[model samples]
Target: MFSGAQLSLYPMSDDFVGIITGALSALDPHRDHLRIETDDLSTLIVGPPEILFSAMRDLFVAAARSGTHCVLSATVSRGCPGEPDDPICTPAEGTLPVAPLDERIAKAVAAVKAAPETGQPVACQVSLYPLGVNQHMDEIEGCIAFLKASGVFDRPKNFCTKLSGDAGAVFATLQQAFTRFGAAASHVALDVTVSAHSPTRA
Candidate 1:
């Protein structure tokens, strides 16, 4: 199963357009469904749990960083399951969809804000990399042991295989998550999801 957060951004700016689009493109592939529609501000993306999950916990900071307000009042659309028809034509960027950092950070922040408080559980799953290919899994395991031993793993959990915290807590969590892992966690050739919540308006 998969999940994500849906967001309606307000007062969208031109600069944010590219950033939001890029982040959306980076994370959209993991979704069973996705969308970006024009709004009075700029655009709104419905990031289902499967698409972003709690990994987007940093959205609040991202929005502030982008200097935009992400409205919480949203209207969500259910996704129709099944593979999308292949486009008749292709572009230079190819078949992958895209969005910007403004949207990306907003999506993450909203996801965290909408996360269940207390009783709800979130996880941070880390993938260890050796900075170069051809490293053995055993070496990777050792590195993980050392990192965990550093006492970082004992922190509160959020999302699935990703960070989860209150709106104020996620920015730093995401920083570490992104740094040790590839910025996009591509070294693992996988996407980070921030699910474990129901839905939100923003």
Candidate 2:
């Protein structure tokens, strides 16, 4: 089992460099916890699913706090061949051979909940890709219904769902969505772009 992601960040402003640097700086503290490599195009992070998602949450939130429009694009994968055969990429007994999406989501939600509050709501946009699953649309629709009923989902935007609320509640909803869908689907991949401090933030 191996889990990793290639992430690219784009800050839609003239001060893009500053925003990018800020996000990288935030991730610096977690370097000891992950295997990270940065190139001109993207940053590759490899580690346990929980740690990867936690680091991503912190990096994205720090960038969002810059008060600029920022987008983080990531292609996440697991069980890749030729990856380092280390504990970080190894699965424990009784868990999926690939990265466990449910656990990853729980860890990500915890990270979001632990983030410092700014007296304003935070928002995140997410798209879930459940690969090799039958009746995928039905599962997606069910997840959407759960998100809406949870009251954290703001709306559906183009290819993703917008979630806004107190950070804890919003993240909890995310955890629920991932857990439910992941359990029903064979393989789940998520593409997420979050704005911790939305333009509407007070």
Candidate with maximal TM-score: 2
lDDT of 2 by residue, 1-202 (tens): 5667788887778998988887788787768768888999999988756556656766776777777776677776654445545576443332452244444444445544564443435677878776676767866776666666665678898999988875446545544454446433155666766555446643
Clashing pairs in 2: none
C-alpha lDDT score of every prediction, in listed order? 0.34, 0.64
Candidate 2, superposed: residue stretches over 4 Å from native: 79-86, 90-121, 135-138, 149-151, 166-180, 183-186, 196-202
**Predicted candidate 1 versus true structure: per-residue lDDT over 79-162, tens digit per residue:** 212223223212123322223333433443443344343332333343433233354454444333333433224332342233
Q: Model 1 off-target regions past 4 Å?
A: 1-132, 136-139, 146-164, 167-171, 181-190, 196-202
